[model samples]
Target: MVSRTTEARTPPPPSLWHHRAFRLFWAADSVSQFGTYIGNTILPLVAATTLAATPFEMGLLSAAETAGYLLIGLPAGVWVSRVRQRRLMRHANTVRALLLCTVPVAWWYGLLTAPQMIVVALLCSVCAVLFDVAYQSHLPVLVGRDQLLEGNARLQSSQSLAQITGPGAGGTLVQLAGPAYPVLGTALGYLTAALLLRRIRDPDPPAPADSPRVPLLTEIREGLRYTARTRTLRAITACTATANFFNGVLSAVQVLFLTSTLALTDAAVGAVLGVLGMGGLVGAVCAHRVVRRLGQARAVWLVPLATFPSLLLVPLAGRGVLLAPALAGLFITGFGTVVYNVAQVSYRQVICPEAMLARVNATVRFLGFGALTLGALLGGGLGELVGIRPTLWIAAAGTSLAALWVVGSPLRGMRDFGCRAGGADRPWS
Candidate 1:
């Protein structure tokens, strides 16, 4: 493990806002996040309200959108390793914008079929996976190692704030302008993001010709091997994958629990989910401070373990104003999730070697979020066989178990794992 020594005498780096390249990167990502949210909000509306899509069709649309992660995740990482990241991101954004534009155009001509929508969603998700992987991998390059925590926190905070506003704004736009038209705004958002992204002039290192030309499969295997060999990375990956698996299960049923069991009005349900986004924003705002105080390693294990128990309250949510307990539960869960993500992601970025960062991130994404896809299928199947509420109870138990993966690992006792993810100076303080 590599450990970084802090020169306490050295002052902190300049603010990211003052860094023109970072500012553009931030703006581009902010715009793209909002656009993605708008697409998420409005496309479902188009499917349900305009096309009168069946449940199966809707499910297919979602699957098509997410399939890219399952299909191209590792390859995208390999691609990132072999090319200029910003260039990849720029093209990804432009392609997504064009793909989104096609949806409205097809709809306008009355030619948008369920299959067409599915295809567009699949292609757009492909771009999304590529762009997202490149975006994370590019950050450490742009900001340098020492500033990773602040950079990630700021970026995450931006995403959380976008999550808070984007869906509602998109919904409102759809109501005002029709679902097909609202998607035009999403296209525009991505286009704007592409333009902003193009303005960044980071001195990105070109892929070295002298580097061994490893086979793609070999590259993928090496990333997996490296992550598995790193004790903390492996543990963190297990914890995150566990959480994602259950979260996927919860996500598949959260709406049903809110609507059918709790009998919440649509507006009430929106408000509750909104609270989760708000909590995420709060958590992002506080992450760096919490990490500084708790030390990054302790923050990772403790944050999730501390707050995840609240998930049980979700399955017990009551109807109407009696929903406070569930709301509180979700809020705490959201807060802990954001805090955990900020710390662990920063740790991964700082610890992984630059040559391996994209591949490592890709491998991690595959392991971590791949569970989400499986859990979605599991949740759906279980919901069909058992019922919604029972399925939720099972999922809650699963989420509760995620912390066990980390608690037994190196993170459980670390106090100050300095540079290189080396051992902390003392046990958990």
Candidate 2:
């Protein structure tokens, strides 16, 4: 039998997009993604502006949405292992679509209340968590190992394109048709996603009957242990988690900083953010080339370093030419984030075992998303105490620190995802 290292070195099969099933899935995901972006922009504005929610109340809404990631991530992973991934994704999107519709319905009936909106947000968030975990787990099987990075780049590019138009369109729709109606659009998007998911052919074979079924706790521990044992995975996880923590903090304060500190209108803020989407699109398109030239290890290091230039503009918030600097900074930040994500995700997908994909994904997300929640809390409280500019400065400092996670790790030297010497047969080929 061929050694794992030899197998790893061999090229994987051709791309999955040539298959009709994957093409449909891709189309559906692209269309629905636009809708998700619309909802993302409209939801918080509805809570704060329409409901007259306090900062603390708004923070609670954010927390409620993210908290599900912490609560259900591990369990969802374990549960996903026993079911068909495509079916679970279809159901998840369906439920999300249905639940999102309730927001507009509540408003139509004059029954919209803060507590009810919070509940809707929480439920919708839970569905999002489920769909994301299932979707990520399914990708490796759908596309072979060699094309994983390209596949992800295509997905990210779609999302970035959606972001370019989604927010401004969402804002206009909300202004014209009201906040509740935008959610209807989001609901329809989910329906489209579900329809697309249905057309994708299942790629993973059925689990072995003789495969051991471990205890839930043991299964979770095994997933974590596997991640810990892998040098590349450990570095990727650390880098992603740290980056997310700081990025979350910045996200929490961005709108407030733009509007209050920089003296920009809401429209201006939205326009600037919409423009930043282009940077993400550029990064996604260039990621493959960057990885090819720099190698995976160097790409990870380089992406985060791109973010540092943006942080320098934080202190220039109130200067005469502030708008130009701020817009430029956000664009660069968006670019860095997408590049970093592509490197980290592609590496994770290649190294992880097929069986543990969902569990490992859930575990990583649980920790990273939990950090996001904490970061938001920290940003909000710090912003209140020291003002938005200072809060932003601190958040930037934290984000800069994320680069350290991989600087000295073994991941810094990794050239690719091939198996180690003397290991089992390479799975990618």
Candidate 3:
């Protein structure tokens, strides 16, 4: 028999981004994200300008776009577990490309009705959810466990870059060629993504034939159970869900508030959004160092503290000269959001078991996206009743309370995932 020392040898060198498979996947995702940013701007413009949709109709359109996250999130998680994740992603990407292509065709035929747009949006949303879940699950397989944070940071940075450039280009394209033309860009992006994904050799270990297969409900419950039982994850989820809720409210009212109340032009609104992306770029670049210096627990609390005060700028925007302060506030809010997101996502990816990743991610997304839907509904109704400014004030107040969920919980003092095993033995169990 081999000696104990010999049996305890080091593992192989980790794969680098230069690895051909990883390069292909990264390139695909980078281009796909840029396209998504372009599509985001054009889609709403299509609904509002081309179709002449009302505020309620626009809210419904937004709601319909996110509805897939709530409806298919869990079921998609289950379905993904039974298939090869890479193959699933390829199919999903193909479907998304086809669906996006239809929009331009319908526009050419003058058959792009509001109802048809809603249907296309819903279908595209569902496909996106599938692609996202599969794509995230595929990461651990490609990059290995140790490089997860760095890999995620790279992806986030690329996405932020896309946000900064895509909107300006999309807006220009819309002005020149019409709203439908920009969607062709999105379709081509998806097609390129699919081709690149096809080149990624599956690096994941084969699934064990005898691995236990749990019921769908039981699998979901298991995921939730694990997350609820883990202190860091629980706090992060609560904080993120709450943030999404309040932000959703703000999103629903922001354009309306700008256009109707402050009487700002669409061009001005686009400029502000682009500035917000600049702030996000700063946050994303600095997130890793910030987490290392501040520690993860402190970083979690810092997010809201940095962000919530900015909401005051919203009401202040109605005052003539204060509009600059409001824009600054929005920038700060975007910065804090990016910082919080990087930490939270990295932490979750590190702590969770490999097998449960898809389910846990889906469950968290379901809660967060559901909150977004509710917030949009509430914001629309409340804005109609109390007026936009007061509605924004309420959103600010609600957002401030989100930090409370973390303060009293186990997340308050925890420093890292290294302490998790000991903390898992607490009374919260």
Candidate 4:
């Protein structure tokens, strides 16, 4: 492993709020995030309600949402690296908006089916993969590396806010207009985001003309190799992948648990899910303060370690007094997840060479989200065989174990990233 001990004491740049391109990027992303959360709630509800999908079918639908990350994540990174990221992201948003439009149209014509919804979800996942890779790769260039934590936290806060309002809005729309029409707002979110992206005045830095082009497989291998060799990165990857796999299991059955098991109405379900976003918003707002108090390395592992235990309360949820535990559990999960993400993602962006950032990120997502795909299938099967409650317990336990990957790794010995043996520690790079 190549471990650097240098302190980053570089002077801070102007605040990102003053940067025009970044402001546009942030605004566009905020609009897109609102739509994404709405789709996240309504799509599965469509399968469960209108189509009467089985638990296993729900698994298939959920897996389809992330299948593109497993299938095209690595290759998408290479493509993202070669393109103008702003334009690429715009195209991805447009495609997602168009694909989502098909769902409501099919419903209007009374042609909507579980199969069609799954197909649309799968196609949107492909666009999501492209957009995510481009966005992550483009952030450093847009705001400079020093501002990653601030930028990510802001973006995460927006997403958290959407989570609160989006699900509530979706459930209300479903009650008023049926499940189909609520998707109109979801599609409009993406379309509006794409339009807003056109106003960005700054351009990506031009790639070096003299740089030799490598074969696709060669580039993929290079990225994989780098992630494998970095012990810290490898540990983080393992932690995130394990958590996502189990999270997939939870996602597969969570709605079923709420609606079928608890007998909650669609609007009530949306409100419960919205609570998850509320926790995330608090976490995002507090992430910087936590990092300053706990150090980045500690924040990454310790927060999850402290908070994940709440997940055990989810399976215990019942109709009356028991629901409070589940709410607490979901809130804590969201808070810990966002805090851990802000810390680790910024850490990786700081350490990885800029040339390899996209590839390394792709590799991480391929492994992490690929596991999520498999876990969703497993969760559905388990829910059918054993039951929803048992499956949830299993998922909660498995997710908690994920913190061990980082706790036992080299991160335990360091106070802050690159500060174990260095002089005055760097401000976030």
Among the numbered candidates, top lDDT falls to 4
Candidate with better lDDT, 1 vs 2: 1
Q: What does candidate 1's lDDT look like per residue over 64-169, in tens digits?
A: 5566778888887899989988888889988998888888788778798778887888889889888989999999989888888889999888887776677567
lDDT of each: 0.79, 0.72, 0.73, 0.86
Candidate 3 per-residue C-alpha lDDT over 151-270 given as tens digits, one digit per residue, 9 for 90 to 100: 676677777777677766776677678867789878888888888888877653455568887788898887778777776678778887887787667766776676567765545555
Which portions of model 3 show Cα errors greater than 4 Å? 1-19, 202-207, 262-267, 318-322, 420-427
Report the C-alpha lDDT of model 2 over 128-221, residue by residue, as the tens digit: 7787787787777777776788888888888887877787777667657787778987888888888887766666445556888778888888
| Residue runs of model 4 more than 4 Å from their true location after superposition | 1-12, 421-429
- Which structure among the candidates has the greatest TM-score? 4
Worst 10 residues of 3 by lDDT: 418-427
**How well is each residue in 234-326 modelled by candidate 4, as lDDT tens digits?**
888999999999999998999999989999878888899998899999999999789879998888889989987789989989998889999
**Which of the two candidates, 1 or 2, achieves a greater TM-score against the reference?**
1
Per-candidate clash tally: 4, 1, 0, 0
> Which pairs of residues collide in model 2?
4-424
Q: Which candidate model has the greater TM-score, 2 or 3?
A: 3
Listed in order, each prediction's TM-score against the native is 0.89, 0.89, 0.89, 0.94
Candidate 2 minimal-lDDT segment of 10 residues:
420-429
In Å, residue 87's CA in model 3 sits off its true spot by 2.1
TM-score of 1: 0.89
